[model samples]
Target: MTALGTYVKVWLALIALTGLTVTAAGLHLGSLSVLAAILIASVKSSLVLSFFMNLRSEERVFKVMLGVAMATMAVIMLLTFVDVWYR
Candidate 1:
């Protein structure tokens, strides 16, 4: 697909994800609601990183770095959750 076509598709996906995020917020799922929102936000961020940021064409090192960063953030989030749960 052309650049414009790809961008349009990503834009549409972002819009749909945004709507889903809003809908998820309205529901009373307690702890699951936070997880759902985080998962949806992660998907949206991944789409933006892969498409809008043109990360697909980036070098392997950059991709690896991004992965490490994401992993680190995940670990931190998990720690926070554990701490909160124990308290």
Candidate 2:
């Protein structure tokens, strides 16, 4: 597909994901609701980073930096969840 087509597809996917996030928020899943939201947000972010940010066409170092940043965020989120679970 062309660049414009690819962008359109990604935009559509983002809109669908946003709708899903809103629907998930309206449900009563307790702690799972937060997890679902986070998962959806992560997917959305990845799509934006890979396409809209043009990361896929960038150098290997940029991808490594992005991975490191994502890993650090995951670690922080895991620690927070662990602390909350014990409380």
lDDT of each: 0.92, 0.94
Question: How high a TM-score does candidate 2 get?
Answer: 0.78
Clashing pairs in 1: none
lDDT of 1 by residue, 5-81 (tens): 99999999999999998999999888999999999998999999989988988889989999899899999999999
What are the per-model numbers of colliding residue pairs? 0, 0
What TM-score number comes out for model 1? 0.78
Regions more than 4 Å wrong, model 1: 75-87
- Report clash pairs, candidate 2: none
lDDT of 2 by residue, 42-79 (tens): 89998999899988888999999988998999999999
